[model samples]
Target: MTRSTDSWIQQLSTLMGDFYQLLAKMQYLDLDQGTIDYPPYIDPEKSVDTILATQLGINPEAIQLLQRLPYVAAPARWNHGAGDEEFVLYGCFADFRKDGELEESRDPLYASIDPKDESVGWEDEDGQYMRPWYVPLSRLGNHGVVLILNMKNRHLWVIDQEGGCSDPGLSDVDWNEDLVNKNSLDRYPSRPATEVLRDLMQKFISLEWIPGGIHHGYQHHHYKRLYLAHGWPDNFDSPAFNATRQVWEDEERAQYSAERPFQDVDRLELWTQLPTISSQLARCEAENASPAWHAQFQGGSGRIPYESRKAELLARLPGEQQRRQELLRELEQARRDVVGVSGEVRRRREERLRLDGR
Candidate 1:
């Protein structure tokens, strides 16, 4: 552990405690006495696995943990503090598989195949050679302030590590070519390594998985504490009632019944007009073999025998039949009117011929 970055590494060990505090606060979680005794952030004399099991509520034996390069930040260089300044930043690491395999090793080819490929012997090569990449966490330094985040959980870690203006060693200086190779920049994780570098750059300016720009929408959170506490970002101005209404309507008109029905009856209002009687008849005819379809349509107020349902549909058919007859009568009258008008025009033409003596 006598590496050039040993002190920085030790600083990381210390920093993990602070990072853990931030995560705990973000989740609104509390540590039990056992967890307090053995936390995951710091290296205890005992196995870290035992501690993770006690604290995180997961089987630590099953979980694989990897140490990422610690994020570091250099002091700000101030030549009298103008708008622009070069700040040296450090202390960023990524979590990945211990074996250098895909994040989702169970499914190496995660993305769907492209349908455009039409070669007779061609194989799906898009996700064929791809590896699964997931759940990136990043640490960043802007100017002199360091911002670190666990993207999946939306945890933010901040530390002001910048040395004061009096510290010259921490500020900008001539770099030795020898030292550059000795302590190279650590690599970040990406689907392709380039994307990882890009993400690392953007992490300082933005947080991932969060909606950007002026408008924001719903984001589902599984952790109850985080969901209930944060309540949705203020930028998400969409009314909850309206959003819920649309969801309900979508469920109602959906081809299949919703697996999980909305329990809030007051919120889920259906349209004033019920399913049309004709539509019901059509559905009945199409789904005659399906008992489930029969149960759905024939349930509740319309509970009756199949014969009775048929009779009810047949009972309404006569009214439609009567309307059809009325329409046919009107069509006949219109044709007669046209013939009478033609006869009158013929009579007028004959009168004109007689008057002209032709």
Candidate 2:
């Protein structure tokens, strides 16, 4: 940050950060992803931990909505796992919502393959829900930072863009001044809102937070943005604002200002039809695979009852029974997701499809 005789640059940046924080606090930012078309998504079923929410500076409401919008990723690029890493059955938590946190306050973020929660650990053969969401650590350009949270497992990861955790530059430090100079000896590191948020959030994970025990690198339960076979929601399109007009305080401000595009809220949608369709599709594969789970779909038994089916699974080895149990639990979770979508939402969906032939 160099001295511009005019102070508009600093002010404009503050205004951009404030606007996002405001929308989230107001709960007007729509985080819902849509449903009904092709590959479907379910609304978020679980709540993000309150303590975790406060620390990430993400609105808890936003997270609940985000969970509904799993990445529609098929065979998502995953590192750290072995054979079962190529996944199609489960969509992961494709991304986290902390970009705003970093810009507003320069927190020293770090990336890690390690997490404090023991349950948060994943094997190469593990399925989707067991993983957390991640954004690339390289996103931290000069000052770009991202915070990764595994709400399902209550595990947290901090990604420091610098990558040089030990040899950080003065450019990366926030020392209570607008411009942090590289060749000066003036101030100590100052605490920003993000730093405060980071410290208060460590203890709630599955294990106590200990920096020494964790590993480096990233992991995922990544889900890509899935489009519904049905189509986009009617209100998904929010009217664009005249950001330039709104934020420019004066001519000097106008010269230095550029729009800070905020994330639109239409990202979350949990309408009943989509998840039902998703379950049906997955169930179709499960049924087709039942006769051939061992050999990866040789024949088909067409989905059988739980008690009667266990005897039929191929390869009865040391972990066969446990694997079957996890699969059942995952299936049951999907079923619970579809159980109570409202009649009105269903009626509206029916009306829309009938009208549009979607």
**TM-scores of the models, in the order given:** 0.24, 0.19
Question: Per-residue lDDT tens digits of candidate 2, residues 78-178?
Answer: 22221111111111112223334222221223223223335532332221111222211112323333333333222223333443221122337544333
Q: What lDDT tens digits, residue by residue, belong to model 1 across residues 27-114?
A: 2112332121212336433223333322322222123222322221212111111111222133222222223221322211223332
Candidate 2: Cα lDDT at 358? 51
Model 2 / residue 236 / CA error / Å: 26
Give the lDDT of residue 75 in candidate 2.
25
Task: Give the Cα lDDT of each candidate.
Answer: 0.31, 0.29
Leading candidate by TM-score: 1
